[model samples]
Target: MANASSAATLSICSSSSSSFFSHIPTRVPSQFSFNHQKPKCRLLTIRAAVYTAPSPTPMPAASSSGIVLVDKSDSDKVNRLKSVYLEKIVPILKEEFGYNNIHEVPGIEKIVVNCGMGDAEQNSKGLEATIKDLSLITGQRPVKTRAKKSIASFKLREGTTVGIAVTLRGNVMYSFLDRLINLGFPRTRDFQGVNPNSFDGHGNYSIGMRDQSVFPEIRYEALGKTRGMDVCITTSANTDNEAQRLLALLGMPFKEGAGPTVLLRRKRKKAHHFDSKIKGKK
Candidate 1:
């Protein structure tokens, strides 16, 4: 009985040891295996995306052919002063001047408006104001005139802006002249006729205004300073006589006892005196 009991106890101990060994795995399963060559390392190259801006679209080039088209309807319409010149002034000039061809009759070419700023070096604002006032008066932009050379006596420097000027031609010239003759001159205080002797030897006439206030365009209250202006009327005439006649016919008021006849007489006297002097010298 003791030997059978010992055998039973030995069997039971071996069975319990085998069950414990079964519970704890001796070899890892295929799912958890570390022998699969580490998935070949794969060097995961994470390519970062870079942003780029698109190029601007090119603009269409302008037409190289410099052809300019004019409107016929607009060209047909004549300016007020232009029509007057064609209809009335042309015939009058032809008859009076004994002009065989109508083309020979002299006409106004252009008008130049100038404003000199004597104190431009000292006062820049005055220069600016003069430019503004001139533009207002002329209905065109005035170009700033600069000193060509430095003048110590006048305190002027080279390239210093000392004046402003505007040149008017075509319909604009006629319009401005008409306005100046009819409106501007009449508006002056203690108004008198323009100087008849203001003609240059080269058939150009000049008129000086004391201030720009005479023009309807300028506002007296808005003006910073009283500015003077010079108006030079250039003509296609051959002589001062022709130019004077042309201007007088176009409604330039001359002072009493100072007309083209007087100018002609003065010129004749000067020529006669010059001739006499030459004879005496001989």
Candidate 2:
């Protein structure tokens, strides 16, 4: 049973539809007398066994890197506003992106994910604790986040087929958007949906933050120090086009740029007033 358990824990994260890699190395220019060193050949078969399941193929040249997927899991929103990288986000990337060399080795190496809470001091303590929590769970020093936003985001690298995160979410995301207008920032209101071109046909997507200052904490130079929050979400496709197709099938807004520009996508807030007597003598 111990042996069986070990093997089960080591299963590849594929859909069981595919898993095979092969290579035959042929010598190049062996006849040159001055070049006496024999060429080295490699034959390896590393299955689709990263934290997330990856598509099957020969290991890519070492030059390419993978992406890390993140999902914010902190809010009572029941999966909204929380910062986390789910086990499944990886498989989705594998199925969509064609990085045979990708991996899912786990660790929690970055950022807080809670949507609402205390001020900067409390936020700092919480973030440090959360980073420790991730490290403990994954059995290694956590990887750096691709983008950290609010307190509920942490992710891996880009374009490597790892799970980064899809967490520009929740009512808070909308709330933060609201503050943007009051602060006199230029932005499109009633944002019906993000551009689906952010992902590819297979189901992988990337979230690009147009302006990080939209978040109050990010812009707070003294009270809060923001992280670099730009991320590239890699899916199962080798390119962005395929990931966008998959997101479209999922009801994601692909070309909502389709509607007329005249109708703004928001409703104006009604004015409110409070009655109170002044303390100063008339």
Candidate 3:
């Protein structure tokens, strides 16, 4: 009876031990694995983030392009006034209409330079001489131009401010432009092309000429002497935007696709820009 009881107790303990071992996790020497029976709960948190980049800058328009801008110095209105148009208008007319040709557009007000001398009493004798000199060159009297002095400008310096402009048709503007460029600008050693944004919104430009002879680069030998000019071209009074439109129509190289509205910059200025002419020590 004692042996039977002992045997029964041993069997019961062995079975319980086996069941506990089965419920506990077991590891193999070589590797281990998970059952993964439960559904994944982390999928709801995943999301895609949207991102974007900026656009590129466009180039300048063409029509408003011209020469260097000179600082206006203190001088009388007449001395301050220099019209590049006076120098080239005839040529433009000739180029478009063929020699001595003038294009007549009745609606647009013709640009005329004014000396605002008020009355003869205000017009000094010196003014008379200047007017006579002007008369000899331009057949028309020095009528007042519709443009006013730049308000921010301190004062109109005599022989300082020069007016530059372009008044030619697509075809004529082209022909005269060839002549002016060929005669005016030298082949700058690394010349690319002229800036399209030289003009204001009103399609006008006034830049300084180094000298009359800086142009006339027809032959290498002819540079020493040539009749050069300083001038400006102005448009019929309108908004700056419309002026840009007119210049684009005339073939000014606006950096942007169609025409010049604002001025264009060739190379961008960098944060660490340096001038070749100056010592970069500082």
Which one wins on TM-score?
Answer: 1
Residue 62 lDDT, candidate 2, scale 0-100: 20
Global lDDT of each model? 0.78, 0.36, 0.41
TM-score of each: 0.63, 0.23, 0.27
The candidates, ranked best first by TM-score, are: 1, 3, 2
In model 1, the number of clashes is 0
lDDT for each residue of candidate 3 in 1-282, tens digit (9 for 90 to 100):
999999999999999999989988676545555566887676567678968667762321223343212223312223211222333232443353343424431112333223333233344554454444333333334433223544446444343323222234433333334344444445333344445456565546533333443333233453332222334546653454445443333333344444444556799776556564355664
Q: How accurate is candidate 1 locally (lDDT)?
A: 0.78
lDDT tens string, model 2, 26-137?
Answer: 4446565374588898989889855967867432222111323222332233332122223333344456555464453221122222222133233656455433432332
Task: Give the Å shift of residue 169 in candidate 3.
Answer: 13
Worst 10 residues of 3 by lDDT: 74-83
Enumerate clash totals for all models, in the order shown.
Answer: 0, 41, 38
Model 1: CA > 4 A from native: 1-78, 260-282
- Candidate 2 global Cα RMSD: 30.7
Off by over 4 Å in 2: 1-192, 196-204, 210-223, 226-228, 238-241, 257-282
Tens digits of per-residue lDDT for model 1 on 13-45?
999999989899788898888775655566789
Assess candidate 3 and give its lDDT: 0.41
